[model samples]
Target: MRRASGSGAVAVAAVLGDGARYEAGRTQQTVRAGQRITVSGHGCTVRQICAYRVVLEPAAEPDKAAAAAAPSSPRPVGGEADGGFCFTTNPTVLATASKGFPPRGDTLSVLDNGGVRRFPAGLSITVSYVDTRTRTARLRGDCAAVAVADYDNARVGDTVEFAGVLFTVSGLTERAIRLKRTST
Candidate 1:
């Protein structure tokens, strides 16, 4: 195991003693399995993260304790796709309406049984009845045509690109699109 000792604000990470892996911010991957690691920098903290698995571990036989405890077929869900931030498929989204519209910051929720545990962002859908004679190029979509625009197509994970606002999708509904507050 190898270790780097530092006392400063910058992040300085390293292995513990022998056969440990430390590559900057990517991951403290150690060649030695079950080797403990210690990270020291700015706010030095220790979090015991599950070792990354290369192959899926399988479930053990119901009758055999040893087999049940040690199976190599599956691993935990959510890999590099989840990035780092934890999220839920039915993440509650909240959005505020523009002036004269419904109160903003309304919350919405969706049910996904597919273990869909990902909430990217929400979008604010504005519906307006366009005059057939008048052509609004910018405000031209199936959503802006009817008096009551339905957000049926809006689903979780779909990027809601707006002219002025950026949001992470939380949930979606026929009448509303769930959005979480975020930067521009």
Candidate 2:
């Protein structure tokens, strides 16, 4: 994978099964597991995403001849042509209050995913009160309560909207909850 010049988007080289190589183009699309993308008109579902490589599975039968005969020109898909990264589309982690921390403030590790995950310093919810037992959290942005997670008890795969951004609860643990941003 290579970063596009001046854009910072990731560009990958797609190699077909028949040894045909082509540039998959630069995409700023925040893809998640199970999302579909088209490479040179061949549909593929994103299987797994790592820091360097994105694994894709064939979503439909490929037009082998078409892919092989196509030019090596870059084709943009999924993301906008504009530059700059969009943080709202990626997965985010939120930490729950542990044994003895007060329900307020924004500096504790246990209350902020061990300080490993944050909302980019000034965007989205800045402070949250999470209940590990109930698996819920009261998210606050700029001292105003913006969202809560008690409507459905914050189970895995549950979705919550915080500060106008929709996110799916992709993972949950005693320490943190993983939220993946969704188009909806």
Candidate 3:
């Protein structure tokens, strides 16, 4: 589960014992605070929604068999062991602020101006800019120039497709923008 940063929403991605997957664009639903959302076959109540995280209370005990079958950690992608990407506010400075720091166990790679990094698939993301408000960021497709109107209102937790790949706005701050590769 991940909070929507500025938005008071949380994205819950879960899989059930029956192999039913729940995530953004699939079984996506909006529920009020204190409401319960059932993902696949599991139910949980939204206890609190904060600036950085969402608190949830499980409605029932987990199925031991299903829990055992679940992977201990998410599989890595793009040859990244942590499966996350970080971009800092100061393109000239590297990882100077906590907000711009990469996730624990993740490596940092500073991209030069006009530089492009290719992932395992055809997905390639270029940082358009990190918002000064610290609440949003814009991603360009293959380092191409994108119009401001194209992504002016994109919020955290929003998913956008570029080429054939899907990327999720995972985290945002004044110093950094974090994106997670969803699919290709």
Candidate 4:
């Protein structure tokens, strides 16, 4: 089966001394075991390299179309300022997950995901810290980075403001900042 995007897996077909042979399109490479390499649709650490045909699993796609088709919140009669990425008739619905953030930050991977790719430098985004228990936007910010386009200005300890609330930039990447709500 073909996947619309992302990498697939590959397997070895022949044992050639120190490596195994696999055809990634027209090009062939003898990848040794334990090598960290990426082939056309395949990538990741090679768990074991031996003679077996590669089996490619289809790339998993998120069902964004359905979510996108969900009824949108109505626009205000008069636009509301300081309203960060409003999506519900109610003002407290959390958007971090639909916007591609993890349900919660285990460490800083959440920041890196947004910073390095989804919300890259120069792109303005409305950010909020959602408390998992209540799933509400505790602190919100409408922001742009002050430095280069990769969002490298965001470091582990800086802070920014949202509607008078001070949220600390808890994690970062070259293009994104991960924040946590702090008592102000």
Candidate 5:
């Protein structure tokens, strides 16, 4: 074992046997395993960190004590997707339900969960609707990207729920839907 030291604001002073004095900033580090080192430098008032490795004996029977001591995986949070909605929470659902919507990095929790789920900053919609004239309703294909106007097949006065928000389709095109928010 060896002694290590670090400094905050005051410099470390060492006195020699002959009454000589040496003053310098003190910082400590572990250059290698089982060895600690301290170096003196100018204005080095930073915190000291050290790393070491521990070795445990191999278990005689793998399941005897290991299962009791092993930690179980943590439970999923409310927003975690496990065989449920792709975007579980209201805010996440809202952020992902619309195309051309900016992503707030500060609000994102899970960075990646395998497949692609990002959209460009354009008005895209996956609309399933019943034609008012013919009264026909069908589900759109998954990953079906289309303009807002095409959602209801150019129906001028139709509404759809996206991310739990209702939007009245006011105008349309092959790739864009002009929507009027009717409710919060």
Candidate 6:
């Protein structure tokens, strides 16, 4: 089946890696990873702008054959990332790091796999705390940052170094912070 207009996972892959960019008409653009660039679409040509940011949606890779896999459910709209990145209907979701922030004062939250993944990359925030396994971050620390990054980016089960933190996402209408884990 054909996807709406020109939206396809392959089209997203067509612009993979940094330095590669594509403009899809006047409403859409694709920019590769690891580079600050904007892929904007004109009437028929997509323009690449320097020093701008582009975000790519992540497609879920199935663990088994498509026929064997269960039909997936729709992700929550405007939700945050807990297990992984969230999918957004709007493609302009991304965050740019303003500076290398210290983990101190850093805030964290979990997205229940609804709206997006890794906060879309262009969000900004203040460092509340950081460790190899977990990040302690506050929502108000940065607004755009909350919208751009995800804690599931956290990696666990490392013998030595780890970054993914243990936390829960709260405050749906406002800033959500880490709910302290009560000892059993």
> What TM-score, computed on C-alpha atoms, does each candidate reach?
0.20, 0.27, 0.33, 0.23, 0.26, 0.17
Model 6's C-alpha root-mean-square deviation from the true structure amounts to 17.8
Question: 44-160, model 4: which lDDT tens digit per residue?
Answer: 344453212222222223222321332243222222321322221222222331233322332223322222323311123332232333222211222222211111123344443
Best-fitting candidate, scored by TM-score? 3
Stretches off by above 4 angstroms in model 6 are 1-105, 115-154, 157-184
The TM-score of predicted model 1 comes to 0.20
Model 2 misplacement above 4 A = 1-121, 143-153
lDDT tens readout by residue for model 1, 1-184: 1111112112223233211124444443333333333322211123321111111112223322332232122221333322111111111211121211222344333232211112222122342222223211111111111111122233344333232223334554333335553432
Off by over 4 Å in 4: 1-152, 174-176
Report, for every candidate in turn, its global Cα lDDT versus the true structure: 0.25, 0.35, 0.40, 0.30, 0.29, 0.24
Give the alpha carbon lDDT tens digit for every residue of 89-123 in model 5.
32433343443332322111111112222332222
Name the candidate that leads on lDDT: 3
Stretches of candidate 5 exceeding 4 Å from the true structure: 1-124, 127-154
Question: Against the hidden true structure, what lDDT does model 5 obtain?
Answer: 0.29
Candidate 5 local lDDT, residue 148: 18
What tens digits encode model 2's per-residue C-alpha lDDT throughout 1-184? Answer: 2111212233344222311224255334455667777654667687754322345566654343332232222221212321111112212211211111223222222233332222321222321444566655433322111111122244445544442344554554555555565633
| Residue-wise C-alpha lDDT for candidate 3, range 46-99, written one tens digit per residue | 776433334455677543233223223322243332212211112222122222
lDDT measured at residue 15 in model 4 versus the true structure, 0 to 100: 26
Give the C-alpha miss distance for residue 134 in model 5, angstroms: 11
Assess candidate 3 and give its TM-score to the true structure.
0.33
The CA-based lDDT of model 1 is what? 0.25
Q: Once superposed on the true structure, which residue ranges of model 3 sit more than 4 Å away at CA?
A: 1-25, 63-184
Pairs that clash in candidate 5? 100-121, 100-122, 147-175, 147-176, 148-176, 148-177, 149-172, 149-176, 149-177
TM-score (C-alpha, index-matched) for candidate 5: 0.26
Ranking according to TM-score, highest score first: 3, 2, 5, 4, 1, 6
